[model samples]
Target: MAIASSQPNSPAHPWPSLVPKTGMIVTLLFVLLLLFMLDIALGSVHIPLKSVVAILFGNETGQVAWEKIVMTIRLPKALTAVIAGSALSVSGLQMQTLFRNPLAGPSVLGISAGASLGVAVVMLASGGAANAFAIRQLGLGGSWLIVLAATAGAMAVLLVVLGVAVRIRDNVVLLIVGIMVGNITVSIISIWQYFSAPEEIQDYLIWTFGSLGGVFGSQLAVLAGVVTVGLLISFSTSKPLNVLLLGENYARSLGMGTFSTRMFVILATSLLAGSVTGFCGPIGFIGIAVPHLARSILNTSDHRFLMPSSALMGAILMLACDIIAQMPGTQTTLPINAVTALIGSPVVIWVIVRQKNLRASFS
Candidate 1:
């Protein structure tokens, strides 16, 4: 998690010039609203924007089916996209700041993999298989069960990573350990898959592909609650994260306890990443990409600005991805993971190139 500069705005550092924060924030909010409405309107049914707005405001849209679709299906899905997007992006921002690495993301430490492992246990493990029929029969209750399993799995891994983090001084080594742990978790999932029934394997596979539509009603409420708590934790640590950007020794010199701060960050990230994975499956790219996007757009490293910017940008991106996944007028829908990957891959390449430029400028 160490980087070269121990001072955030040092004279020799090559950070980008700051932009007008207020303007950018307002723009992001407006875009988020636009995309939210668009995501609801452009689904397979193509409900008119007017009707969507009308239904949202408690007015009769005349078409009962449109009202039901907007209120029941698309609205919940859109909200899920917003919540999940912000959760992952904020988690990524915190991780990147903690590691002082542009590529650090929620998945980087295998937290998402751990969550998946939890889901795998429920969906594919021998004991889970025996109760699979009953679990599905439980419907929304079953979904909550999976959410709990995923959160537990994520925390199980977080505990291991934190245990290692406390003993390891090197961020790079901790990163390697996290990756190794994640790989081991994936291998365990694979072993479970191999022995499970084909139907069970298929169910687990769908979960990996991810879906925002799966969360709604009481499920949406739970996801929202979890994410709100995580974001508040992340936001409260903005000052600590800033000091950390100056390196651990400097942070300690400033009266911050390095160990405690690190633990809090890891815990906050686990809650956000773990809960989102539990509810929406493991969403990729946004966690790794949105922070960089926010940093670049905002042109500063201040967590105060970066966190909210990342959240709004993430929500907008997720809503856009969801709309594309719906394929608009077509009944066919693409996997949200696939859509995010397609869009996120390019942003990552840009990040690499930008980092290279930063290095060259510093040299």
Candidate 2:
């Protein structure tokens, strides 16, 4: 009888190739840190980089107004953008992998539509009353009720999509169904808008434009907690996801529970997408485009590397968009969603056009 070998290059051990991957990881981390600092420092109000660091470290000798600007406005907005970007990008990657479609994303699948619907109900239905007395009676004062409604909307759509995905085997058909769901949600929102009061409609329109500044300091802890929990869940599933890349039957043969894994992915996507859309409005393009960007940069689909790289890339892209939204030259700030769309859409179209064998490779 031959003894099983435990040598470093044995079949079980394989050749250790950590050095290159580790180097890539470290490089990505450094780039992410640099981008984050730039995001915080380069804004409408130009503060010296050293002064920005000092303000962050509790050195209050700097200009009192500059400190207020950093602490109150730019820092929180930049942080929110980072969190939202990371969460949306990861969720999009998971959705694409789960559905095995390049076009899969929260907005495409009506997750954002669900969030919009929730906001519509709160702002249009509940808060539509002419008098303040009626608004108070409906419990729509602060943004909390709207957030709750949006969350409920997102979960509802997620549940529907999960059910559809299970029954529908063809990836193309599932993608179409997701788009139809989004259209249906848009129709609902349109009806609400038509009947909504002008004041309420104007408010809803502003929300639709999207703004990271909508999230206040008080709400940051809750947003961070939700996003952190969802991210951990996604990271934990990387191994199974790698197996899943081999197809459902192969994954099952490897002892993976396809149904449970799919359910968890749906749940995580819902939480991440729902929370961000609820707090920050239906941010566009980051989810749909960031994963592809990360994959193209890394030139590998291995989830172990892809997941974290996508997260950092998403954060960086989002922070950069936020910085752009605050256009340094112009007095008026642009909408966050518009900035993401302008940047993300061109990249997405380029990917579709340039990757000649994209569909064939997936098939």
Candidate 3:
């Protein structure tokens, strides 16, 4: 948990600036707070900044509907965006470090793909009137079914990956295997889609597009609880993760439990990815892109800074994307997935091209 000092160093790869890690973290927190507030204030209804602030502080201001809007609708949605955003970002950071790849995230290990497959089986393959009861019995109710199914699917994929990783010693090989598993699951989903009813197919398609506004009450609890625990585990692994950056054998020589650390990381990633996918329907790009953004800002790979900064950066990105998805006026909301990909793809590309020593964090 050492704060990267502000003093300039004479290393082969000095940072572009002399800013302290604390400063970057503080700045990111400020931006995160502002973005979060904006997410709560700006929407189709368009509550004023003052009013939104006042409402949050328990000042009614004579508008009951506004209060309801802030508390019941916008608040939950914004929280979901933040929680899911941060969780996905950390998960991506872990994957990138674990596999030592520039482009790795929840999908890198096919957990989300498995979740999608699970939802497909429930909503598409078993969408008939006769099978509706069976679906509900499996916690695939009209509302939370997709969430549970996605979690189950992600866990299933995670378990398989863990089994393979235990048997196979190569990181590159494990990465490829994860991708292959995802492809196989997706192919099965396609087959399921082809034979499903039109409504079932449409439902599955909508889930893939993603929705942040659907979680609340018990669903929100499940999502929040799982994400919170996952984040704690992720944060705890910062030291081990940093050790991992120097390579496994080097870490092992230092007495770090490489296998146990990997298992912990995988478990945390599964919980974060699974819960978010189950509730939010596989929101993309933030997980894959935000870690690089954090590293570029801090100019260090230290997880102490990278983890919190990536989480905040992710929350900011998600808030902005969620706001854009809401369209800011009238009664229309675009799919969150499209907005994130539209924004995140360019940022990722720019980081790849603009940044020097993309693996500096590892070094």
Candidate 4:
């Protein structure tokens, strides 16, 4: 009172402090809850909020169709968005950290393209013979064959990339190799597309459109298991990943098993990215953009904080995008890839622009 403080930026005596982590967590939980409710309420078929809530709680007496919609359709779609988003985002963060490159992600590494090639082979080059044989012998059908082919293809690419990463010391060069790998795969796919029938080409084209709603309850278990294992593997190596932030020589000096650490990271990334792409199609932009968004929000590059934050932020962003994709007023939904690109590209560009010195800094 006697004298005004000279420090104007002191924030008027700390200003009661920012919200605590617990408060932030609670707020995020509430936001997720609201988003979940919105997802249930605003689908193609109009369901009243009360009925949606009742259906969720198994108390809907006269709303069987609503219950079915909420439980069978929208719930799985929402969960897929959450799980796929978290998995892709966390995987992207791990890749970026391991490579010391902000632009690294599963798609950029051509894992998705590998998966796409696999699907193309199965659907086109395999002569649709495998599908017929599976339906006849094992009772397996169309999409299941595609999923298996995609998963196998993604894993194969992962192995190749891991091998290359171990041999190549430069991250930028490795990235270029990954891009080349993707291009090669695309060329193979194009060849197959040219030789395949129009109907098969249409099917492949539709699959490429990407959709979170593709995973049903029956397939959720497989998706959940693979993603959980992948994430756990990544989480366990947080210490190594953190070490990796310092150059490989520095990590070796610090007693880290550089080769093994790199292998595990690559495998984990492949699993996470592959599983999501296998089930949801090649989801674009989420992996590349979400990690940067998390870094910006947390203001720290620590993997310990960044991974979890990226997971949550990714889930929220993906869920919101899926909701928009549904386009409640329209009968048809927008492609998930398109929505993600529209939302994520600008953010990525901003990150690149704002961090103009990132390349030199990392180098």
Candidate 4 residue lDDT tens string, 1-363: 212223445666644322223344456567777787887788689788888788888794597788888888898888898899999999998888877777788786788999998888766765566663453353222266677888988877777777788899776777888888889889999998998878677777877988787687668888999999998888888888877888878888999997788778778888899989998899988997888876655555557667777778788878888888888877888888898898668866787678654454356
Better of 1 and 3 by TM-score: 3
Best by TM-score: 3
Q: Which residue pairs overlap in candidate 2's backbone?
A: none
Score each candidate by Cα lDDT.
0.85, 0.78, 0.85, 0.79
What is the descending TM-score order?
Answer: 3, 1, 2, 4
lDDT of 3 at 9: 79
lDDT of 1 by residue, 1-363 (tens): 123233457678756434335678888899999999999999779888888889899998689999889889999999999998999999999988788777789998899999999989888873754498766665622388788888899989989999999999777788889989999999999998988889888878888888899887998998899899999999988889988888878988999977778888888898899989988898888998888777767667778888999999899989989999999989899999999999777865777577654332112
Q: What TM-score goes with each of the models? A: 0.89, 0.86, 0.91, 0.85
Which scores higher on TM-score, 2 or 3? 3
Error of 2 at 361 (Å): 5.3
TM-score of candidate 4 to 2 decimals: 0.85
lDDT of model 1, residue 314:
90
Give the per-residue lDDT digits (tens) of candidate 3, residues 196-218.
77767876788899888888877
Clashes of each: 1, 0, 1, 0
Q: Give lDDT for model 1.
A: 0.85
